[model samples]
Target: MTTKFGFTLMSIQEFETWIDARQLARTVLTIQEHHTYSPAYTQFNGSNHFALQQGMKNYHVNANGWSDIGQHFTTFPDGTIMTGRSLEKSPACVVGQNANAICIENLGNFDSGKDAMTPAHRDTIIRITAKLCKRFRLPVNTNSIVYHHWFDLSTGERNNGTKNNKTCPGTSFFGGNKVADCVANFLPLVTQAGAPAAPVISASAVLKYVSVTASSLNIRTKPNASSPKATDRDAAALGAILRVYKETNGWYKISGSQEHWVLGKYTTDVKRATVKADTLNARSGPGTTFQKLGSYTKGQELFIVKEQNGWCKVNMDDRWVSKDYLVFA
Candidate 1:
């Protein structure tokens, strides 16, 4: 393992261990696969890993005007994985479908007749993807692990590459980039890729759930701030719901088996719920008299931070909805 230019480079084995120890605040549902069309195999020389990664970050920040590198992780031709953007933030790789998603940019053009996939690189890609799916409790399905070519570039809709889609992940990525191709060629490898178990505690075991009120909350190994970070990138983003398993001093244990703890001061009580009504209005205050911000369709997920009378605050801010329309999860 090595660190350079604000990125941590690790082998496939190290990544599996590192991922299991992380205590992410946001719930992840999908894993996006992409190909770095610009920095092809020609640019790689078995070295210069940091230089290439830093170049992408500079382009994303300056030219693209994004806060940081778009992808959360990048896979090198040498089978090394380098960290990019924060795991807490939604990736900028996919346009309209970044929420609750993790993006992996394989470092190659990967188009037909361009950069034939190396054996080592292929192994890394497969293993890392399987590890992420296991870590996030996501199933190895088309909806969970997807190719960049599946989404429309203009509308960010999942049109399955019918139109307005770039051959991203490419025409020759793992044989092909189409949904059918993924089902036939790519997904099987990920599903069969051997991965260790990720223990998830049942809801009954959870003492309570809390919503992060602060913009970013640091996760510590012990109950005190003096303890080391629980993981390399250890802060949970705002609006992330944490399941508290144990309480010690002023800290809350956010993980089931890991020693990950966070300050109770930065969090507020919350409940997991799903919208039961056909359409539920989100208001500024607890009453219908308050201004309506937006509406949530049926089956939409939300965390209730505060409840007053028959209304529930859906978020940390003033967003409120009728508790009558919610089914507690």
Candidate 2:
């Protein structure tokens, strides 16, 4: 039989209710430990303390195998979630640390085999990680989330002093970490209101190109003129795909592509051929200024529907801009 940590789904109201129900006598982890992943019938590696103590590296056992508790949680191949060591209390998943971090043991050995991680596992990690981040007030993306390998990298230590054969989460699941990064990239900005100052992708990752040009560009907030604003943000390159949310005017309103501004002036070129060319230039009035507002290159993409007298109407990347701009590209 499998046990589940009983956590009620939390909303602001639900959180308040939980707070009202408790007098702060227990830790936060104890109050909300719902969600769990059960141990399935699978072969086990002798990576537990018992195996380590016996100088053996692999072993087989009952459904509830390990001699000592391992992992703060388990994510099944089927995507179910399970609890292990207390969330508030640290566990020994990463070596030399059991006081500050939580351990989640995912099944599979990507380091030595060709078996791939199931979609169920990837989805579970994403859901659970987001929940953990929300509960801890941590940023919800790659910048905040890290892999065990990252922990190892930052610590500058090897797992048990051996480097040749210690593959923990497997290579396939390592890719799952990238998936987590992608999720972290979009969630927060999507949940917020108003336009971002520029494309501010909360997380970092690769972006594909959709369009291109070669002139210097500005990122504005609203897609209108008389808004009278030009951001220091640049997006002037060829084939450069900076993570971005939307493009208005000739400028691209990028607030969800990266954590900061890459600007239109600095991009190199557009990479993809399918990307449609649509650049809105910053105009004086509705559409009288033959003068150029800004420019852009390939790999940058934006939508254009609003229009004013030969001028294309679009929003700016900055919040202060109240009007749109126009461009002829």
Candidate 3:
């Protein structure tokens, strides 16, 4: 690995090995494809990986006011991989979709009639994407592997290359940046590169709701401490409600479009219920004799951790309320 500006540049094989050994603490669901629009192909000298990386970092940090370079990795025309932002943090790529994502910024602009993609770069991109899919157990599809062109540039909503979107990965990236283009020209190669089939969650698996008890909990790509992290701050936070799909070895797999697992030890499994009363007191204990912690609005979602004597524990903490004011979900 070549280190510069505290970032490591690696060959595809090295990257594969490095990522294989990492243990992340967040959940990641999507892989975003983007092109460095400004730098273009001519800026690269084929060996200035460090210089280019530092330049991008300066821009992202100073101009954009981001904590670091926006993407997790950068792919060069020669197929070298340069690490950027922390994999543990969410990328500042697509606005609303940055949660649970890993972003890749290709070195050259790829718009139609722009820089021609080199054979090495094309092969590397495909291989790296496939490797990530296999490592994270993500299915090769439009949802799991996404293009920046699919979102609105302003509002950051998924519009499928419709109104107000930038041609990001680019207008000519892999035949086109639309969802149909991915299905036709991109996903097949990713599948051929050996993306594993998605695991099927059985109906027999009991579904449970839970709230994060830790100040910041790690959402993993798999149900173990050795797995890479998946979700960043956008998707997970203290008191955030998460749906548990399955359980294994004290880890709970969260219900979502992707495979995200969190340690059950850091979360409190609860029943989802809404408030029935216009205003109900949240107490320090299960009975009315307990101190009033606060009051909740009607229709507010409450996590019922434990039920007792017509009262429900609203959180992992000792907050409770009468069961009569709650409508169990």
Candidate 4:
């Protein structure tokens, strides 16, 4: 294991042990898969992992204005897994759906006909995913493991990669980024990823999850915005998740014990739902005439943030799907 620039670089073997010993403070219901589209395979000459990681942190903190790197970890083409943001904090990867999630930024552009993934990189992705599943006691399915391509970029809703989505983790990633592709090509591998022991779960006291919509949400000492800022942390970056324990007068108690709170107006409630249809159309508007954005496959799960006209607005965005095909949980 290696540590540099406030990040830890570890081999897959080392990561397995490291993850097992961690005492994560928040619940992790899902694992996010992403790709560093810019620093594609071509940029990796094998010894620059630390430099690349620092560069990404610089971009996320300075350019994106995030509190830290957007992901919890980054998987490289050489199969190294480098730690980024704190595991205790929610990732800033997907909008609105980032709470209770762990993000993995794979170092490659896996778009169609681009960045032929190396064998080492491919193996690390699968193993890391499986290990996390086992560690979290999460079901090995599309809902628990997600691809960045499935969400709308602006609203952070899961519309199955409809319009306004970036083909992240790419279209050709592990066969493809489609939900069907995950069910067909990726999930089965995760199910068989490790020694097949019954998973041991670590419980969390989180009541529900909320995503910070405000570019920078203040962490108040009390439920109101007028309260002083928390001493430990000043702000919660947009797309970060807050583990809500209680609510009061448009404010949510984000900390379990302390008075850390944030205004509810800047955060949207998230609901997880599964598609009942073999293929459901996500539209630009609530009606059929709006525009067919994309199709969601049966059993695929996504986050819904709004409801209107018999349609569910996904991830607080313009993408809507017929409510007739949804089964909420």
* Best-performing candidate as measured by lDDT: 1
Separately for all candidates shown, the number of backbone clashes (residues 3 or more apart, or on different chains) is: 0, 73, 7, 1
lDDT of 3 by residue, 1-329 (tens): 88978889988889888886664444455789999987888998988999998999999999999988999999999989998877766688986557557899998989999989999899889988988887766778776788988877754546677788888898889999898998899889888877765633434344777767677777788899999877442335555556677889999887544577889998877687767887677777889899765555555455677888898886544678899988886
Write one digit per residue (lDDT tens) for candidate 4, span 1-329. Answer: 98988899999999999998764434476899999998888888899999999999999999999988999999998899999987767788987567668999999899999999999999999999999988877788776889988888875556777678899989899999988999899888877786233435335466677766887777788887677887665477665556688889988888665777888898877767788998787788888999776566677666677788899886634578999999986
TM-score of each: 0.74, 0.35, 0.66, 0.66
Candidate 1 positional error at 133, Å: 1.8
Model 1 regions lying over 4 Å from their true place: 195-213, 220-233, 246-252, 258-329
Better of 1 and 2 by lDDT: 1
lDDT of model number 4:
0.81
For model 4 the local lDDT of residue 196 reads 31
| Ordering by lDDT | 1, 4, 3, 2
**119-140 per-residue lDDT for model 2 (tens digits):** 6555555555544444433443
Answer with 1 or 3, whichever has the higher lDDT: 1
Ten-residue stretch with the least lDDT total in model 1: 195-204
Q: How much lDDT does each candidate structure score? A: 0.82, 0.34, 0.78, 0.81
Model 2 steric clash total: 73
Candidate 3 residues lying further than 4 Å off, grouped into runs, are 200-329
The TM-score that candidate 4 achieves is 0.66
